[model samples]
Target: MNSYMKHGFAVAALSAACNAAFAADDITVIKIGSAAPTTGAIANLGKENENGARLAVEDVNRRGLVINGKKIKLELDAVDDQADPRQGTQVAQRLVDDGVVAVVGHLNSGVSIAASRIYHDAQILQISPDSTNPKFTQQGFNTTYRLVATDAQQSPVLAHYALETLKAKKVAIVDDSTAYGQGLADQFSSAVKSGGATVVAREATNDKTIDFKGVITKIKGQSPDVIFYGGMDATAGPFIKQVAQLGLNAKVLGGDGTCSDEVIALAGPAVDRLVCSIAGLPLSRMKAGPAFEKEYQQRFGMPVQIYAPYAYDAVMVIVDAMKKSGSTDHAKILAAASATDYQGLTGQIQFDDKGDVRSPRLTLYGYKDGKKTLLTTMTP
Candidate 1:
């Protein structure tokens, strides 16, 4: 009796050890990094991008991803860049140093452009969900990918819409002087002049400024049919409010930075005269939009401002690439990303040779009755 009991106990101990070893070998953790301004003036947009990445991580984990015969658990490493280039580069290095397999952040084009060099040096895949300055993808860095349309495409579409649809014969322009703001304004100004519209005035400001009285007063003298502002919702909202205060009747135009629900809160009644362009189709138009919006609201307890869906897609794109390659190695992910053909909430996402979305579309929007209303969708 004693010998038999001892043998049974020995066999059970061996089985338990083997089971623990198998369980340990069957799971792998994949960390993905994201950076955006979650505390600054445009933090709403940054938060949107972050939430997207977070949602993607959660969603991927829920589905129980299996890669190379091992169960994969995705982790999101998120940081705030304050939409500043210096902080962006810092966050980029932090993510790289932390050994993230991929990154999905830096909402501002300026931040994305600055931080991209760090990601490139580390050979990590960096996908920006909203940065649209055009220069971010032109730097010959195969590690960089953007899920949205660039300003090179958006500004022209917006300018032509202003001329043809809005009939803005005389346009005034203001830029916040940041990389994203200035670059987009430059593109829009060029397109406006080319479209046979008159640019009566041009002005510049900083990202942190709250008052735009000087520029508004100067622009008002010109009696512009439309006043184009190239900046985020923070400055753009207050500037639109000032325009209304001073009795300027010109329609305010901007890029995706100002095409958000935050503008309604920032401008109040002045939002009625605001028109902006986003880098993709309106959320309501996407086949997956309703479901995503529902899930996002349930998880985050707030509505998406902008770029959340794109950010989610960016993370998913990286995960999809990792799956295709059956590895989380940066180089393999980058190669797989170069050939991405996934249809996401933002539509088909396929990168061009320069790492920009292929045939990216721009969506024009206007605020009416304190809500964002889609005006039209255009491509260039």
Candidate 2:
């Protein structure tokens, strides 16, 4: 053949080879579900959690991830649970039905507890970014996992802080009557009592109750050195505001739910007296936290509230499992996730047999100068 003919033949053969390789490396979509209270009192928290998951999905896609010899495209199926248990279960069913290989949400411990059974039955992996109540992992579901420490871990820290750090003799406790609220309150009450502190008053309220005057009136009579609230920022904010209004001198304490930027905004000047516990190191303390926060703010146009890093890490954890398993099969993903020990932006995430993060850390934070100030870090 002539030189031109030979060159043309070589180019045609190379084109054929490239086409075959491209056809063999087909792309597939893998769906991940995230459910949270996207519309109710604590929507800011839920939105922040979802944003973390979104950022993970975006990053994974941008990186051109491949699994089992096939190019993978991650898709997030984020749902609004309204922060309601009933709604959470419904969302769980929907996510399972939608064939998500894994899930990365249900920010409330109550929601996570209620929704976990569904994910378990579906054999899909469910990793919670927040959800600190101990009952979440105690139910013994293989599919259940959490990125943060449980209420069993946080309540004692808060209780000890109130008793030792704050030097409180008399304490009053209030719960929002939900699974999470009641659970944490019970743990705190027990912890304080065990520490030789007095729980002078115990009150109950619903998550939606805006008025705390009646409860405060009852609690004021006790004259507690600190009042611990077992609820989210929406309720805790108003409760703290009322604490200031009622001329109550006691400090306010709460778990991860009340630990957010929204709390300071809601409580206004009253936030000075507010102290809260979050499940891991503060954003400033995490090695990758500062950079993650900067990138997250640039991507989402908002600062990280709480659990965004956890949620982001949860997504990465699930994807890491998928990569290890080399398949998107639910069972394989669950097995891989159960054995995950990924080092995420949050921390080293290694799950114990109960699907809980081992050696989880907690941080005590208070608002100072309109920003969250880290008081201490503890492991309980």
Q: What TM-score would every model get versus the actual structure?
A: 0.94, 0.93
Off by over 4 Å in 1: 1-25
State model 1's lDDT.
Answer: 0.90
lDDT of 2: 0.91
Model 1 / residue 61 / CA error / Å: 0.7
Model 2 residue runs over 4 Å out of place are 1-25
The TM-score, computed over Cα atoms with residue i paired to residue i, of candidate 2 is: 0.93
Give Cα distance to truth, residue 97, candidate 1, Å: 0.5
lDDT of each: 0.90, 0.91
